[model samples]
Target chain A: MAPYETDDSTRAEDADDLRAGPRRSARYVVPVAVVGVAAATIGLVPALADSGNPDLPKITAQQLIEKIAKSDVQQMSGTVKITTDLGLPNLGGLQNSMASAAPRGGSGSSADPSSKLMELASGTHTVRVATDGQDRQKLSLVESAAEYSLIHDGKDVWGYDSASDQVFHSTAAQDGGKRHDPAPATPKDFADQALKAAGDTTSVTVGGTAQVAGRDAYKLVVKPKQSGSTVGAVTIAVDAKTGMPLKFTLTPASGGAAVVDAGFTKISYARPAASTFRFTPPKGAKVTEEKDGAHGDHRHPKGAGPSSHGLLPGMPGEKGAKGGRKVIGKGWNSIAVLDTGSKGGTPSASGAKGLGGMLGSLGDPVSGKFGKGTVFSTRLINALMMNDGKIYVGAVTKDALVKAADTGH
Target chain B: MSRADPETEGTARTARPAADTGPVTEPAGAGRAPSPLRTLGLLRSELSTTFRRWRTLALLAVLAAVPVLVGIAVRIQTGDGQQSGRGGGGGPAFLTQVTHNGLFLVFTALAATLPFFLPLAVGVVAGDAVAGEANAGTLRYLLVAPAGRTRLLVVKYATTTAFCLVATLVVALSALAVGALLFPLGDLMTISGTRITFADGLGRALLIALAVAVSLTGLAALGLFVSTLTNSGVAAMATTVGLLITVQITDQLPQLHAIQPYLFPHYWLSFADLMRDPVYWDDLVKNLQLQALYAAVFGSAAWARFTTKDVTA
Candidate 1:
C-alpha cells in the first residue's frame, strides 16, 4: 500500500486528469447529443405536427355531421392511399373473389380490378382520384410507367389497363328516364354511406382533432352500440375548412390494425385537369365491350363496406346464374352475403333450419354467439357459413356477420 | 559502406543541427517525412488507390453493364412496339415503358440496381477503405503523412463517398446513353400522373441519381466503421455486406417493423417520390435525416475506435 501510494502532488495531478478526461469528452458528447436530438426532432416534426393539431375548431358530432351533409365539394383531385390488413392467410383468392363480386367497370373496389385488387389485398396502395360533375370522374392507379384507369365521362365508362394493354368500355343506356346515379366509391362516398346508417345502430361522438392531408380535420367516431356486431368503430376525419371527409378508417371489434384505412394523402379543391376525365384507348390496345347490365343495376349503398351488391337482382344459386348477392344490415357496417357455391342459392330459403347442422357438413365449424357455423375468414372479408346455407360475408368481424345472420331474414 | 553511411548520416544529422540529433539520421529521417498534406494531393492519392484496384474497376464495370443489358433486353422484348403494359418481370415495371421512351431506361436501371447492386458496390468500397490499407501495412504510413488520423479517415470516407456518386452516375449515364441510342428521348410522363418536358425530366433524373447516391451515405459510414474493426479487408467487406443484407431482410419482416424505420435501407425507395408530379418530400426528407443519423452515430464510433487503435498491423 505504501509503495503503491503516490505523493500528494502527483495524486492530485492524477485526479485532475481523471476529472478532465470526462470534462474534455463532454465537449464531443454535448454536440453529439444536441445534433442527435436536433435530427430526431426534425425527423419527428411531421408526425408530431400531424398528431398535435392545435388550431382546429372543436365541434360536436352532430354539428360535424351537419357540416359534412350540407358541404358541397365537387371536381376535386388528390392522391389516396388505401391499406387493408385482414388477419387472413393468403389474400390472392379473396381478392379474386372480391374483384369478381365487385361491380365491374367502376372505382368501388379499386381503379384496376385485377391489379389493384391484388395490390391492395395485403399492403398499401396509392391511387389518384378526381371527380368533375355528377357524370364525370376518374380513378387511376399509378404504377411505375403503366397505369390502370377507370374514367366515367357522361355517357360512357372506360376501364383501361396499360400494363395488360386491355380496355373495357361500358356505355350508359339513354332511356328518356330519370335514374338514381350510384356514387363512385370514393372516401367521401364511403364516409357518407357510414354516416347515413348511423341511426340506432351506432353511437356517434366527436373525437379530438387530427391533421389529415395537411388540413385540419375533426375526428368523428361512430361505434356500433350493439354487441351483436363485431364492428369496433368507424372513424371519419372531417375537413374543418371544407367539411369534406378526408379520411375514413374502420377497425373491427376483434382488434388489429384498421381493416380499411382509406384516406387522402394529398388533396386539392381546385378542379382537376379536364383531360383527366377523358380517355381514348391507346392504339393497339385490346378492346372489350362489356354490357352495362352486368354492373349497371347494382348500387353500392354508401356504407356497404368495400363490397356492395344491393343491385344484383338474383342470388347466384337461386337462378343457376353467376349473379346474386344478399346484403344484411345498413350503413358503414353492412355485410353482403354472397353464395359462390356452384349450385344455385342455398338449399334452405328460410334460416329456420339450424345452420350449424348444415354448415357443419361444409366448412370447418367454429362456434360463437351466432351458434354453430362454418367460419372462413380473410384479412379483409369474413364469411360465416350457416347451416341454412347462407354464407354471411363482409369487411366486418365474425360477430357482425353472426348478428347479420340473426337479423338478415 | 559503413564509413560511407556515417558520412552521409553526418549531413542528415547536421541538417537540423538541433539538440536532438538522431543516431541513425540517414534512415530515421523523421523530420523529413512531416510534409503538410494538401487537400488536392490527399484526394488524388485516395482516388488513385481506390480506382486503380482491379476489384474497384470490376465493380464499376459490372454496374455500367447492367443498364446496357437491361436496355438490350427491353429493346428485344418490345421490338414490335405492340407490347402491353409492363408485366411482373425482371427489372422495374418502368422497364416495360423503355420501348416507348428510352429515357425511362435511366429510371428503370436505377430502380433495378438500387435494391442490391448499388448498395453492394458502396458496401464493398467503404468496407475495404480503412481496413484494406491497414491490411496492406500502408495505414501507418498514411497516418504519418501529417494528415492526422482524423484527416486520413476523412479522406478515405470522402473517397468512398465519391465512389457512391460515381457508381450511381455510371448506371444512370449508361442507361441514358443506351436509352438515347435505342429509343427516342422526349417528354416523359411522371409516376404521379403528370407530364414533364424532356429537359425537366432529365433534371429530375439527375436529382434522383443524387438522391440515390446520398441514400447510401448511411451504409458507407456503417461499412467504414466495420472496416475500422479489423485488419482483414476481406473479412470487413463480407461483414459489411452481410449486415446490409441482414438489415434489408429485417426491414422486410413484418414482425420487426417497430425498428424498421431506423434501418439504413428503410427509405431507399423514397427516391421514387422524386418522380411524382409535385414530389412527395416526407419520406425523402426522412430518408435524408435517417442517413444523417446513421452517419453521425457510426462516424463518431469510427473516429473513437480509429483514434485510439494501436496500429499493430
Candidate 2:
C-alpha cells in the first residue's frame, strides 16, 4: 500500500543487475561443475579397471584334475608319514582314538577298556603288500617299501615274489611259506597304498575344515558297498580351496569294528628334484636285477579280501592271562585283537565258544580245549584279559588269540 | 673455518663452513634463546622449496610408482605350483622366485634383504641436491645469509634427508597399497618355508621400511658427498648411480661371494633376515653399523673437502 513507485532509471538498473548475476556466476559455476565432473571421472578409473576384469580367477576341482592329467610328470616318490584315526575291521566298535584301549578277558580281552593295544604309531613303519592272482607258487610279497604296487587292481591278494629278480626271494619265500597267493591286491599293497589313499578325494561336504600344512581342507566321505576288506568305505577330507585331499578313514559297517585311517601332516606340493627319484641298491642288500620290464609275479586266493586281511599266520595260543610276556618274534613285540562275536548276531568261523559257558564244562571233543594250555608257538601278536586277569599274550593267530584268555598254565 | 655449533652436530651438511674468524657475539640485549633448534623448522622450509621444484617432485613421484609396477609384473607371472624349487630332486621350496619388484632385479637381493629400493632412489634424488643449487647459483646467495654456510649446508642436507624419507615413504606406501589392492593381504609363505599371518607380514614390512631408511642414509650421504665434490648436477647423479650399480653387480657373482660382504648393498637387505622365526640380530646389527660408518665417512670427507676446496665454479 505504500508508494508503488520506482524511478525508471533505478528499475532499469535493478533489472540489468539481475540479468548480470547469472552471467557472472556462470563463469565460476561452469568451471566448478567441470572440476567436479573431472574428480568423479578420476574416481571411476579403478571401477572401470575392475569392470574390465569381471571374472576373478577361479580354480576348481575339475581344473585340478585336468592339470594333473596334463602334467608332464615322470614319476614321484618321497618319505610319507601316515597317522590313523580309525582302527581295524575286527575292532569296529573301537573309538577314533589317539591310543588304543585295554582288553577284556583273560583270553585276550582286557579288564580295562581304557588301556591300549599295540599302537601302530610306535615307530618308523614302511610296509609293502602287493598281489597278482597267478601262480600258486609265486612268492608272496611282504616287503615294507612299495614299488610293485597292486592297489589299482582293486582286489584282495597277490602272488609271491620268489621268481622276481626285482627283489630278494628269501624274505619273500619266508613270508609266503605257503605255495599260493590270495587275490588281486595283497598286504604289501595296502600298507603302501594306505598313505597315498589318504590323499584321495572320495566325497565332499561342508564341514569343519582342518589345516593340513596350512591349507584349508574340505571333508570327503567314501563308503564301500561291502565289508571284509581293508577299505570297506573310506571317508576322505580334501582341501576345498586347493582341491587337494588331506585325510582318509576306513570304517567298518559295524560299530566297534575295525577303523583304519590315515592322516597326512606337513604336506608339500613341490615335486622332488631330478636326483631324488633315482635309487641305487646299497651294499649287501639282496636284490636280483631283472633285465627287462618291472619284473615280478603276484597272485591272489579266492577270498573276500586279501589273505593277510585279518592277522598274521603261524601263531601259538592258550596261555593264561598272567602269562606270556616274552617278545620272542622277528619284528619285535606285537599284539593282535580279534572279534569272536559278530555284530550281525551270527558267529564267525573258528568261533571260540563264550568263556562263561565253558567255565564248568568238561573237555568236549568239538567245543573245549579241555583245560588245554599250550606253549605259545608263533610270534607275539595276540593277547587278552582273562579269567586270570593280565595283559598281552604271545598268540599270533585267531586260535592263539582265544588261548590267551587263560593265563593259569 | 667457521665455529662449530656444539649445540648441534659437529659435521653438518655437505658444504664447507666459513673461515673461523670469531664466535657468536651475544647480540645487543639478546634475551630470547636462539630459537629452539631451528633444525626441524629450516628442514621443513627446505622440503617445501624442494617440492616446489617441479623436476624433483616429478622424479620422486615416478620413483614412488615403481613398486606398483612391480606388483603388476608379479600378478602376471606365477603358476599353479612352484616351479623354481621343485624338480627331480630338490623340493618345492627351491622353486620360489623373487618378488615382483623390477628394482629388485637390477639391485639383486636388496629388496628382499633391506627393502633398499626407496633409499637408493633417495640417494639419486638427493645427490644432485646441493649441486643443483650451485648450478642455479643459489648456493652463494644462501651462504651469505645470517644463518651462515654451515647452517646452509645443514639446511640442504636436512632437505635432502626429508626428501629421502618422503620418497621412500611414498614408494613403500604405494607398494603396500598396490600389494593390498592387487594381491591377497593374507598370510605370507616366507622363503624359509614359514607361514606368516597378515599381521606378522605387516610388521615385517614395516621393519623393512626402517631398514630401507637405514640403508638409504648411507647412499644419501654418499650422494651429498658426490654433490659436494662437483658443481655439475649430472656428474653428481652419475657418480652416485654408478657406485650403486657397481656394488649391486658385484654382489651377485659367486666368485665375489667372499668380497660381497664388504659391499654396502651386500647387507642392504639384511633386514629380511629378521623374518626368521627367532630373528637373527647379529647380521642386522652389523648392517646398521656399516651403514652408519658409511654415512659418517662420506659426511666427514665431504665436509673436509668443502671446507678446504676453492669454489671457482
Candidate 3:
C-alpha cells in the first residue's frame, strides 16, 4: 500500500496520473467482471435448471395413448400457466376494443364465463385449478390485483370476481349434471383436444421423456399429416406415474414461439379439499343467477363452448352446432362456416356487428367470388367474416379461408 | 477557492495523527481496520443526517399523502353509487376493493406508487447520499475525521437503504391509517377470491411493504453509484430520476419486451402476489433475485469509484 500524501498539489497530480494509468482502468474491471458473471449466471441457470430430457423406458405412441385412456388418477390441484402468442398486434388495444364493444346487459359482463374465456385468448394467465371427481371443480384466474373464480360444486356453479364484487351463479338442470359454462382449460383439457385430433389425419409419435413440474413424464408428439393445417405439431407431456398430462404445447407451421402453451408449474395428485369447491357470495356482492338453458344460448353465441378447443372455440370438427353452422372440407383443413344472424337472436346479432367491426379494423379487406369480407389472420387461425353475415373460420391460410368461403358450404 | 489547497492539506496532516491514535480517538478509524462499534456510530450519524433534512421529510410526507388522496377519492366515487358500472375493468390493481375493505388501500397505494413515486423518492435520497456531502464540502471534513473511504461509502449505502425502508413504511402506514378511517375493515378477499381474516391481511400488508422496500434497493444502489460519479447533488438526483423514468418507459414498450425482464423495475409489482391466497413465489422470487443482481453490480461499481477517486472536496 502507498503511504498517504500530505501535500495537496502533489496528491492532486498523482490522482491525475493515476487516472491516466492502467490502475484506474483496472478499478473498472471489478464491475465489468461482476456484470460478466451476472450475464453468465443468467444464461447458465436456465440451462442447468432444465437438466435436459429425463431418461425413461421407451413406450410406443399407441401404448402411451392407451396409458392416457386407462389411467384414472382423479382429484388433483395445480397452478397452470397458459401462454398464447397468436401474432396479434397491440393486444392491449384489442382488449380495450373488445371491452368497450362487449354488450353490458347479456353475456359481456366481467363475471360471464364466456367473457372470462375471451380474456384467456391473449397474454399469459395463471390459473389455480382444483378438481374433485367429475362433478366438482374450481378454477381461479389469478391476476395481479384481482381474481376471477369459477367454482362448480355438484349442481350449483358459481363465478366470482373479487375486483367487481359480482357473482354469477347457476344451477345445473337435473340432466345428469351437465355443466353449461366451460371451465378454464387445464393441460388435461388441451391434451384431450390434441388427442382427439390424432386419427388418420395425424401421426402420433413418442418424442422421448421430459420432466414436468418436477415429475417424470413421457412426451407424446402429434403432428398433422395434412399440409393445410396451420398447426405444425402438438406435444403433450404425460406423467409416467399417473398418466395425467402435465404440459401441452402447440407449435405453428410458421415456427416461432408456441402459439398455445399450457403447463403446470406445480401439481399435487392428492385430492383437493372439498371446501375448495364450495362458494358463497360475499356480503354486498351483486349475485346474478342464470336460469337453466338461458346461459348456454347467450354465453356460447357461436354454438361452441370454450372447452371445444380451450382457446378459439368452434375449431375444425367441433360438434353441437344447432343451426346455420356448417363444416366444410375434412380433417385438419376443415373450415366452420356460420351464419351469424340466422338463429343467434338479437344479442348475438348485436355481438356479431360489434365483432365484425372490431375484426374489420384488425384484418385486411379481401374480395373474390365469395364477395367482399375482412380476413383476420393469425399465425394458426384465419377467420374471414363476409359482408353477407357468414363467417368462414379455420386453422388455415387466408387463401384457404377464401376458398372455403367460395365453396359456399 | 484559493484556500482550498491549504485546507485540504491541513485536513490530510491532521488525519494522519488521528490514524496513529487508532480507533479509540476516531469513530471512522482512518488507515486501520474499521471497528464495528464506531462504524455503527458513523452509520447512526449518517442516518440522522439523511433523515433530518427537510428534503427527505418532504419526500416522505408526499408519499404518505398519496394513499390518503387515493382513499378519499375512491370513497367519494363509490359514495356516488356509480361503482357498479365501472367494476374492476380499469385503474391500478386493488383499487376496486378499497371501497369494500379499507385494507385494500395499502395494496392499492403500493401498486400505485411502486412504478414511480416510491422509486422517485428513493432516487432523490440515494442520489444525494454522497454527492450532497461533497457539494457542502463536508465530505473532506468527514474523510479527515479519518473516515475511510470504503467505510464512508458503506455508510452512505446503508443510509440510502434505510431511507428506502422508511419511505415505503410511510406510504404503507399512511394507507393503513387512511383505510381504517375511511372504509369498513373486516375480512379481506384475496386475489383468488378467497376470504382471509383481518389479522392475516395486516400481516400480508407488512410483508408487501417489506417486499416493496426490497425492490427499491437496486435502484437505491444505482443512484448511490451515480452520486459517486459527480459532486453536484442536483445533477446526480436528476440523472438518477431520469434513468428511472427511462427504464420504466422502456419496460412498457412492446418492442423492448425481450429486454424488459432484465430491467430493474420489471417485476416490482410482484409484491401484489403476496395478496394471493397461496402466494405465488415465482415472480416475487425473480424480483428479489434481480434486485440482488443489480445491487451487487452497482454496489461494486460505487465502491470502486469512491475508493479510487481523489476526494479533493
State TM-scores per candidate: 0.75, 0.38, 0.88
For candidate 3, write residues B123-198 as lDDT tens digits.
Answer: 9999998898889988777765554566678888998999999999999999999999998999877766667889
Q: Which lDDT values do the candidates have, in the order given?
A: 0.67, 0.40, 0.77
Checking candidate 3 for backbone clashes, the offending pairs are none
Candidate 2 residue-wise lDDT at B160: 72
lDDT of 3 by residue, A129-168 (tens): 8878879878889876677888888988888887776788
Candidate 1 per-residue lDDT over residues A145-255, each given as its tens digit: 456666777888676654444566767555632223443235785686677567775799998888888888899998877654455778999989889999988777777
Off by over 4 Å in 2: A1-409, B1-35, B78-120, B253-258
Q: Name the best candidate (by TM-score).
A: 3
Residue-level lDDT tens digits of model 2 in A1-409: 0121332222222233344555433333433554465457547975664342122244454443333234332222222233333321232222222112111211111111111112232222322221122211111111211112111112112211111112222122333333322221222223223323222222223333445434555444333222222233445455445454445544544444334444443444443333221122212212332222212221211111111222221111211111213323221112323233322111111122222233223222221232432222111122332322222333234343344333223
Which stretch of 10 consecutive residues in model 2 chain A shows the poorest summed lDDT?
A: A105-114
lDDT, candidate 1, at B53: 88
- State which candidate has the highest lDDT: 3
Worst 10-residue stretch by lDDT in candidate 3 chain B? Answer: B1-10
Name the top DockQ candidate.
3
| Model 3, runs deviating above 4 Å | A1-21, A89-95, A103-108, A173-184, A273-275, A297-323, A340-375, A384-389, A398-409, B1-34, B80-85
Give the true-contact fraction for every prediction, in order.
0.06, 0.00, 0.41
